[model samples]
Target: MTGVVRLRAVDIEDLRVVSALLQDAIIPIADMAFLPDAQQFVMLASRFQWEGRAPEDGPTPDDGAEAATRINCAVHFSGVTAVRRRGVDLRQRGAFLSLLALEPSEGALLLRLSGGADIRLEGGAIECRLSDRGDPWPVPARPDHGLD
Candidate 1:
């Protein structure tokens, strides 16, 4: 329970916060689900803990074997009428997607992923929550977007 985060988003401004928190999150293909009957969509993600650290204080393997942290998080979206995928293959087993951003689209919320994959969640309004699930774990490296 290292700095657990619980956030509820109902608008674009709040979603920006959630998006930043979820940036660089890794999600397994099998961990996502959409329940039409419940009008909800859910997914589990391994998110990098990006708070309380300076921009330059990133993991440096060659410096002194520095370690970073990652935590399991659960993301839930209610009032979801439909879920659509683009450039993603659901049949791929053991595949993972890196989340880049979550933004509001024309008639839905878009989850932009790495490798040009995206998920569109269409519904009446945005009602999303992100909660940390368990203890954080050490990871050797931080996610690099090659932005140097």
Candidate 2:
């Protein structure tokens, strides 16, 4: 069902699918937390679309149909992870989490974050699930200003 996306595979394609879901999402930093001690990065995000459209190509939140398709997502990546953040402060609130790129490296999944930073997780075993909540994804008060 489109309303509920369950992905449990630990494969390259799985990572890509998860990446696609998170593409162009404006995730709050408070909704994300990285536990270096546990080697896990957990995030709750409101993903506008998982159709893999470019940010500019995706429907605006004003588009009622597409906006209703938005899903609240949860992503979890674990296994001997290492994080390197560049040009993004963990202190930032309501930051946009642009998944710049995803690829296979050293037998692991490499997540290229926006601002030239990256996170490498030990297996491609990233888990992502999605569901449409009672309400649609909230549009920012200012156009495009939601980006951090």
Candidate 3:
């Protein structure tokens, strides 16, 4: 996790790398903000926070200190040329992110939320910073073992 996990889509495989790099990122709609004039969208994400959480699944009794410390990061997409969506109402702030997809053809990205909301950005550069004011995220290696 030293160098940036940056991937520019010169081919389809590059997009797959970006997809794998963003595995299991949870985004609360309440923390999302989009600036139309600047053509930028930002979202605060809790990485490794898998979907389908139950009330009892929160910080466990014997979990380590990091259990309570969610790794929140800022994800920014800039230079958006156009945007389109369906079943999305930005006013409501109680949804969770289900997916983030990048289109190789148009260099755009799509954000799919839990409530069947799909926001499509036609053109932008995407990057995520692990800390509030730190540099871009470093590339992650795929784990060889499953959740133990």
Please report the candidate that would top TM-score against the real structure: 1
Clashes of 3: 0
TM-score of each: 0.88, 0.63, 0.54
The predicted structure with the larger TM-score, 1 or 3, is: 1
The TM-score obtained by model 1 is 0.88
Top lDDT: which candidate number? 1
- Residue-level lDDT tens digits of model 2 in 1-148: 1345656536667767766666655566788777879777777767655452234544643433332345677777666466555566777785666656566677466667666766565643444344334444544432232556
| Model 2 quality (TM-score) | 0.63
| Candidate 1 Cα errors over 4 Å, as ranges | 53-66
Model 1 over residues 1-108: C-alpha lDDT tens digits?
247899999999999999988999999999999999999999999998876344355553323233578899999999899999998898985899999999898779
Candidate 3 residues 1-148, lDDT tens each?
Answer: 2223333443456556555545556677798777789877777776542221233646532232222222456666666667777786666689777554444445766665445667776764544333333343322432122557
Q: Residue 125 in model 2: shift from native, Å?
A: 6.5
For candidate 2, the C-alpha RMSD (Å) to the true structure equals: 6.0
Candidate 3, poorest ten consecutive residues by summed lDDT: 61-70
| 1 or 2, greater by TM-score | 1
